[model samples]
Target: MSEVLGHHANEILIVSIVAVVAVGLIGLPGLFALTVPIALFGVVLLSWVAMRQHDRRLCEQCLLSMPLNPSERAVRLKRRFWMAHTGSEPRFLIPYVVVLLASNFATTTTIGRIGWAVMQLSMVYLIMSQSTHRKLQPWCPWCSEGGGGAEVDETDPVLPQDDRQLI
Candidate 1:
Protein backbone atom coordinates (compact mmCIF):
# COMPACT_ATOMS: atom_id res chain seq x y z
CA MET A 1 0.00 0.00 0.00
CA SER A 2 2.78 2.40 0.90
CA GLU A 3 4.60 1.74 -2.32
CA VAL A 4 1.42 2.42 -4.27
CA LEU A 5 0.65 5.58 -2.31
CA GLY A 6 4.29 6.60 -2.15
CA HIS A 7 4.51 6.45 -5.93
CA HIS A 8 1.96 9.26 -6.15
CA ALA A 9 2.51 10.85 -2.76
CA ASN A 10 3.58 14.23 -4.05
CA GLU A 11 0.73 14.54 -6.52
CA ILE A 12 -1.91 13.37 -4.08
CA LEU A 13 -0.52 15.64 -1.35
CA ILE A 14 -0.72 18.63 -3.65
CA VAL A 15 -4.33 17.90 -4.58
CA SER A 16 -5.36 17.44 -0.97
CA ILE A 17 -3.54 20.60 0.05
CA VAL A 18 -5.34 22.51 -2.68
CA ALA A 19 -8.63 21.13 -1.49
CA VAL A 20 -7.80 22.28 2.03
CA VAL A 21 -7.07 25.77 0.75
CA ALA A 22 -10.24 25.88 -1.35
CA VAL A 23 -12.36 24.71 1.56
CA GLY A 24 -10.79 27.37 3.75
CA LEU A 25 -11.33 30.10 1.14
CA ILE A 26 -14.98 29.19 0.93
CA GLY A 27 -15.78 31.37 3.95
CA LEU A 28 -14.87 34.64 2.23
CA PRO A 29 -17.89 36.97 1.99
CA GLY A 30 -17.68 37.46 -1.75
CA LEU A 31 -17.35 33.74 -2.38
CA PHE A 32 -20.84 32.49 -1.93
CA ALA A 33 -22.84 29.78 -3.68
CA LEU A 34 -20.21 29.17 -6.31
CA THR A 35 -17.54 28.57 -3.74
CA VAL A 36 -19.74 26.09 -1.95
CA PRO A 37 -19.98 23.67 -4.84
CA ILE A 38 -16.37 24.26 -5.74
CA ALA A 39 -15.23 23.46 -2.22
CA LEU A 40 -17.62 20.55 -1.97
CA PHE A 41 -16.34 19.28 -5.26
CA GLY A 42 -12.77 19.61 -4.05
CA VAL A 43 -13.52 17.62 -0.91
CA VAL A 44 -15.55 15.05 -2.79
CA LEU A 45 -12.82 14.63 -5.35
CA LEU A 46 -10.21 14.21 -2.64
CA SER A 47 -12.28 11.61 -0.84
CA TRP A 48 -12.90 9.73 -4.04
CA VAL A 49 -9.26 9.67 -5.00
CA ALA A 50 -7.93 8.70 -1.58
CA MET A 51 -10.64 6.23 -0.68
CA ARG A 52 -12.35 5.03 -3.83
CA GLN A 53 -9.96 2.15 -4.33
CA HIS A 54 -10.43 1.06 -0.75
CA ASP A 55 -11.64 -2.52 -0.59
CA ARG A 56 -15.31 -2.43 0.28
CA ARG A 57 -15.02 -5.98 1.61
CA LEU A 58 -12.70 -4.84 4.42
CA CYS A 59 -12.74 -2.01 6.94
CA GLU A 60 -10.05 0.70 6.89
CA GLN A 61 -8.47 -0.60 10.11
CA CYS A 62 -7.91 -3.97 8.56
CA LEU A 63 -6.68 -2.41 5.34
CA LEU A 64 -4.26 -0.12 7.21
CA SER A 65 -3.41 -2.15 10.29
CA MET A 66 0.14 -2.96 11.41
CA PRO A 67 1.15 -5.01 14.36
CA LEU A 68 3.25 -3.18 16.94
CA ASN A 69 4.20 -3.33 20.56
CA PRO A 70 3.05 -0.61 22.94
CA SER A 71 6.09 1.61 22.56
CA GLU A 72 6.23 1.16 18.82
CA ARG A 73 2.57 1.99 18.54
CA ALA A 74 3.21 5.26 20.33
CA VAL A 75 6.16 6.11 18.11
CA ARG A 76 4.45 5.20 14.85
CA LEU A 77 1.07 6.78 15.61
CA LYS A 78 2.72 10.09 16.38
CA ARG A 79 4.75 9.90 13.21
CA ARG A 80 1.81 9.09 10.96
CA PHE A 81 -0.95 11.19 12.49
CA TRP A 82 -0.53 14.05 10.04
CA MET A 83 -0.76 11.81 7.00
CA ALA A 84 -3.92 10.37 8.49
CA HIS A 85 -5.24 13.88 9.04
CA THR A 86 -4.29 14.83 5.51
CA GLY A 87 -6.58 12.12 4.21
CA SER A 88 -9.26 12.70 6.80
CA GLU A 89 -9.96 16.44 6.58
CA PRO A 90 -11.88 16.11 3.33
CA ARG A 91 -13.84 13.21 4.73
CA PHE A 92 -14.79 14.99 7.93
CA LEU A 93 -15.63 18.37 6.39
CA ILE A 94 -18.41 17.23 4.07
CA PRO A 95 -21.25 18.21 6.40
CA TYR A 96 -19.99 21.72 6.91
CA VAL A 97 -19.28 22.09 3.23
CA VAL A 98 -22.77 21.10 2.18
CA VAL A 99 -24.44 23.22 4.85
CA LEU A 100 -22.43 26.25 3.82
CA LEU A 101 -23.40 25.76 0.21
CA ALA A 102 -27.03 25.19 1.08
CA SER A 103 -27.29 28.18 3.35
CA ASN A 104 -25.63 30.40 0.78
CA PHE A 105 -28.24 29.38 -1.78
CA ALA A 106 -31.03 30.16 0.72
CA THR A 107 -32.67 26.77 0.06
CA THR A 108 -32.17 23.44 -1.60
CA THR A 109 -34.53 21.16 -3.47
CA THR A 110 -35.91 18.27 -1.43
CA ILE A 111 -33.79 15.79 -3.30
CA GLY A 112 -30.67 17.92 -2.85
CA ARG A 113 -31.27 18.21 0.86
CA ILE A 114 -31.77 14.49 1.16
CA GLY A 115 -28.62 13.79 -0.78
CA TRP A 116 -26.51 16.23 1.22
CA ALA A 117 -27.88 14.90 4.46
CA VAL A 118 -27.07 11.38 3.48
CA MET A 119 -23.55 12.29 2.40
CA GLN A 120 -22.97 14.24 5.57
CA LEU A 121 -24.19 11.41 7.77
CA SER A 122 -22.16 8.87 5.90
CA MET A 123 -18.97 10.89 6.11
CA VAL A 124 -19.54 11.57 9.79
CA TYR A 125 -19.92 7.88 10.42
CA LEU A 126 -16.77 7.10 8.50
CA ILE A 127 -14.71 9.79 10.21
CA MET A 128 -15.80 8.69 13.67
CA SER A 129 -15.16 5.07 12.87
CA GLN A 130 -11.61 5.79 11.67
CA SER A 131 -10.86 7.84 14.75
CA THR A 132 -12.14 5.08 16.96
CA HIS A 133 -10.00 2.58 15.13
CA ARG A 134 -6.89 4.66 15.69
CA LYS A 135 -7.81 5.22 19.29
CA LEU A 136 -8.19 1.49 19.62
CA GLN A 137 -5.06 0.60 17.67
CA PRO A 138 -2.59 3.43 17.43
CA TRP A 139 0.11 1.80 15.37
CA CYS A 140 0.06 2.04 11.58
CA PRO A 141 2.82 -0.17 10.20
CA TRP A 142 2.28 1.02 6.65
CA CYS A 143 2.56 4.68 7.58
CA SER A 144 5.62 4.10 9.72
CA GLU A 145 7.29 2.06 7.00
CA GLY A 146 6.37 4.49 4.23
CA GLY A 147 7.62 7.50 6.16
CA GLY A 148 10.99 5.85 6.81
CA GLY A 149 11.56 7.67 10.10
CA ALA A 150 10.25 11.02 8.97
CA GLU A 151 10.56 13.63 11.68
CA VAL A 152 7.55 13.69 13.92
CA ASP A 153 5.54 16.90 13.68
CA GLU A 154 5.76 18.82 16.95
CA THR A 155 2.09 19.65 16.85
CA ASP A 156 0.98 16.04 16.64
CA PRO A 157 -0.11 14.58 19.94
CA VAL A 158 1.38 11.33 21.18
CA LEU A 159 -0.90 9.02 23.01
CA PRO A 160 0.25 8.42 26.57
CA GLN A 161 0.54 4.87 27.82
CA ASP A 162 -2.72 5.21 29.76
CA ASP A 163 -4.47 6.67 26.74
CA ARG A 164 -3.19 3.76 24.70
CA GLN A 165 -4.80 1.56 27.33
CA LEU A 166 -8.23 2.59 26.04
CA ILE A 167 -7.77 0.30 23.09
Candidate 2:
Protein backbone atom coordinates (compact mmCIF):
# COMPACT_ATOMS: atom_id res chain seq x y z
CA MET A 1 0.00 0.00 0.00
CA SER A 2 2.75 2.44 0.86
CA GLU A 3 4.63 1.48 -2.31
CA VAL A 4 1.58 2.37 -4.32
CA LEU A 5 1.11 5.70 -2.51
CA GLY A 6 4.77 6.64 -2.92
CA HIS A 7 4.62 5.90 -6.62
CA HIS A 8 1.50 8.01 -7.02
CA ALA A 9 2.95 10.94 -5.09
CA ASN A 10 6.10 10.93 -7.22
CA GLU A 11 3.98 10.77 -10.34
CA ILE A 12 2.04 13.85 -9.26
CA LEU A 13 5.16 15.83 -8.43
CA ILE A 14 6.79 15.02 -11.76
CA VAL A 15 3.73 15.89 -13.80
CA SER A 16 3.11 19.15 -11.96
CA ILE A 17 6.72 20.29 -12.20
CA VAL A 18 6.78 19.52 -15.90
CA ALA A 19 3.58 21.43 -16.50
CA VAL A 20 4.93 24.53 -14.78
CA VAL A 21 8.17 24.41 -16.74
CA ALA A 22 6.35 23.90 -20.01
CA VAL A 23 4.21 26.96 -19.38
CA GLY A 24 7.33 29.04 -18.79
CA LEU A 25 8.92 27.76 -22.00
CA ILE A 26 5.95 28.58 -24.23
CA GLY A 27 6.59 32.34 -24.09
CA LEU A 28 2.87 33.10 -23.85
CA PRO A 29 3.48 36.26 -21.77
CA GLY A 30 0.53 35.59 -19.39
CA LEU A 31 0.10 31.81 -19.39
CA PHE A 32 2.92 31.08 -16.95
CA ALA A 33 1.58 33.78 -14.68
CA LEU A 34 -1.63 31.76 -14.34
CA THR A 35 -0.50 28.15 -14.59
CA VAL A 36 2.39 28.37 -12.16
CA PRO A 37 0.10 28.94 -9.18
CA ILE A 38 -2.01 25.92 -10.10
CA ALA A 39 1.15 23.84 -10.36
CA LEU A 40 2.21 25.05 -6.93
CA PHE A 41 -1.06 23.84 -5.47
CA GLY A 42 -0.30 20.49 -7.02
CA VAL A 43 3.04 20.50 -5.22
CA VAL A 44 1.28 20.77 -1.86
CA LEU A 45 -0.88 17.76 -2.66
CA LEU A 46 2.13 15.83 -3.84
CA SER A 47 4.13 16.54 -0.70
CA TRP A 48 1.30 15.45 1.62
CA VAL A 49 0.88 12.18 -0.24
CA ALA A 50 4.60 11.48 -0.22
CA MET A 51 5.01 12.16 3.52
CA ARG A 52 2.12 9.88 4.44
CA GLN A 53 3.57 7.11 2.31
CA HIS A 54 6.96 7.44 3.96
CA ASP A 55 5.46 7.07 7.44
CA ARG A 56 3.39 4.08 6.43
CA ARG A 57 6.41 2.30 4.92
CA LEU A 58 8.47 2.91 8.03
CA CYS A 59 5.79 1.43 10.28
CA GLU A 60 5.36 -1.66 8.11
CA GLN A 61 9.07 -2.45 8.05
CA CYS A 62 9.67 -1.98 11.79
CA LEU A 63 7.74 -5.00 13.03
CA LEU A 64 8.98 -6.01 16.53
CA SER A 65 8.23 -9.74 16.38
CA MET A 66 11.12 -10.26 13.94
CA PRO A 67 13.80 -10.06 16.71
CA LEU A 68 16.37 -8.17 14.66
CA ASN A 69 17.34 -6.05 17.70
CA PRO A 70 18.00 -2.71 16.04
CA SER A 71 19.95 -0.52 18.43
CA GLU A 72 17.77 1.74 20.55
CA ARG A 73 19.78 4.82 19.68
CA ALA A 74 19.59 4.20 15.95
CA VAL A 75 15.84 3.59 16.05
CA ARG A 76 15.26 6.75 18.06
CA LEU A 77 17.34 8.86 15.71
CA LYS A 78 15.59 7.52 12.65
CA ARG A 79 12.18 8.18 14.18
CA ARG A 80 13.14 11.76 15.02
CA PHE A 81 14.39 12.33 11.49
CA TRP A 82 11.13 11.05 10.03
CA MET A 83 9.10 13.37 12.26
CA ALA A 84 11.16 16.42 11.30
CA HIS A 85 10.89 15.72 7.59
CA THR A 86 7.15 15.12 7.77
CA GLY A 87 6.64 18.33 9.70
CA SER A 88 8.38 20.52 7.12
CA GLU A 89 6.22 19.64 4.11
CA PRO A 90 3.49 22.18 4.74
CA ARG A 91 5.84 24.99 5.63
CA PHE A 92 7.67 24.73 2.29
CA LEU A 93 4.68 24.04 0.06
CA ILE A 94 2.43 26.83 1.36
CA PRO A 95 4.97 29.58 0.77
CA TYR A 96 5.62 28.19 -2.70
CA VAL A 97 1.95 28.36 -3.59
CA VAL A 98 1.64 31.92 -2.30
CA VAL A 99 4.68 33.08 -4.22
CA LEU A 100 3.40 31.47 -7.38
CA LEU A 101 0.00 33.12 -6.98
CA ALA A 102 1.55 36.53 -6.34
CA SER A 103 3.73 36.15 -9.43
CA ASN A 104 0.66 36.03 -11.67
CA PHE A 105 0.08 39.76 -11.36
CA ALA A 106 3.67 40.65 -12.27
CA THR A 107 3.18 39.14 -15.78
CA THR A 108 6.21 39.77 -18.08
CA THR A 109 8.46 41.17 -15.35
CA THR A 110 11.83 39.78 -14.24
CA ILE A 111 10.38 39.18 -10.76
CA GLY A 112 7.82 36.74 -12.15
CA ARG A 113 10.53 34.70 -13.88
CA ILE A 114 12.68 34.63 -10.78
CA GLY A 115 9.76 33.61 -8.62
CA TRP A 116 8.94 30.71 -10.91
CA ALA A 117 12.54 29.55 -10.79
CA VAL A 118 12.53 29.69 -7.01
CA MET A 119 9.38 27.61 -6.84
CA GLN A 120 10.94 24.93 -9.06
CA LEU A 121 14.12 24.87 -7.00
CA SER A 122 12.17 24.58 -3.75
CA MET A 123 10.14 21.68 -5.05
CA VAL A 124 13.28 19.82 -6.13
CA TYR A 125 14.93 20.39 -2.79
CA LEU A 126 11.92 19.17 -0.82
CA ILE A 127 11.58 15.97 -2.84
CA MET A 128 15.25 15.06 -2.64
CA SER A 129 15.73 15.94 1.02
CA GLN A 130 12.54 14.49 2.44
CA SER A 131 11.93 11.39 0.33
CA THR A 132 15.30 10.03 -0.78
CA HIS A 133 17.07 10.40 2.55
CA ARG A 134 14.32 8.64 4.49
CA LYS A 135 14.07 5.61 2.24
CA LEU A 136 14.81 2.30 4.00
CA GLN A 137 17.96 0.32 3.38
CA PRO A 138 18.11 -3.43 2.57
CA TRP A 139 15.88 -5.77 4.56
CA CYS A 140 17.46 -7.75 7.43
CA PRO A 141 17.86 -11.42 6.55
CA TRP A 142 16.81 -12.66 10.00
CA CYS A 143 13.63 -10.63 9.83
CA SER A 144 12.89 -11.74 6.28
CA GLU A 145 13.64 -15.43 7.00
CA GLY A 146 11.60 -15.75 10.18
CA GLY A 147 14.42 -15.30 12.75
CA GLY A 148 16.93 -17.49 10.95
CA GLY A 149 19.36 -18.52 13.75
CA ALA A 150 17.97 -21.37 15.87
CA GLU A 151 15.02 -23.55 15.07
CA VAL A 152 12.17 -22.74 17.42
CA ASP A 153 9.63 -25.52 17.96
CA GLU A 154 6.19 -24.54 16.75
CA THR A 155 4.44 -25.78 19.89
CA ASP A 156 6.94 -24.68 22.62
CA PRO A 157 6.47 -21.30 24.26
CA VAL A 158 10.11 -21.34 25.38
CA LEU A 159 13.23 -23.10 24.15
CA PRO A 160 14.80 -25.99 26.18
CA GLN A 161 18.04 -25.29 28.01
CA ASP A 162 20.77 -27.58 29.50
CA ASP A 163 18.60 -28.55 32.49
CA ARG A 164 21.13 -27.60 35.28
CA GLN A 165 19.01 -24.82 36.95
CA LEU A 166 22.25 -23.31 38.44
CA ILE A 167 23.30 -23.78 42.12
Number of the top TM-score candidate: 2
lDDT, candidates in the order shown: 0.47, 0.53
Q: Could you give me the TM-score of model 2 versus the true structure?
A: 0.41
The per-residue C-alpha lDDT of model 1 at residue 120 equals 40
lDDT of 1 by residue, 1-167 (tens): 74455333334544554454344433356656456657656655655555434322234454455354555655645534554444356664665576645643432465554454444444444443444334433354544665643323244445566666677
Candidate 2 stretches greater than 4 Å from native: 27-51, 58-97, 136-167
Maximum-lDDT candidate: 2
TM-score of 1: 0.29
Error of 1 at 132 (Å): 2.3
Tens digits of per-residue lDDT, candidate 2, 1-167, equal 65555545654675676666556645545676776667677785865677565544434433432235444433544544343344356885577677767765664777777666666655655554444333422222322244432222134335677668773
Q: How far is candidate 2 from the true structure (C-alpha RMSD, Å)?
A: 14.2
- For candidate 2, give the lDDT: 0.53
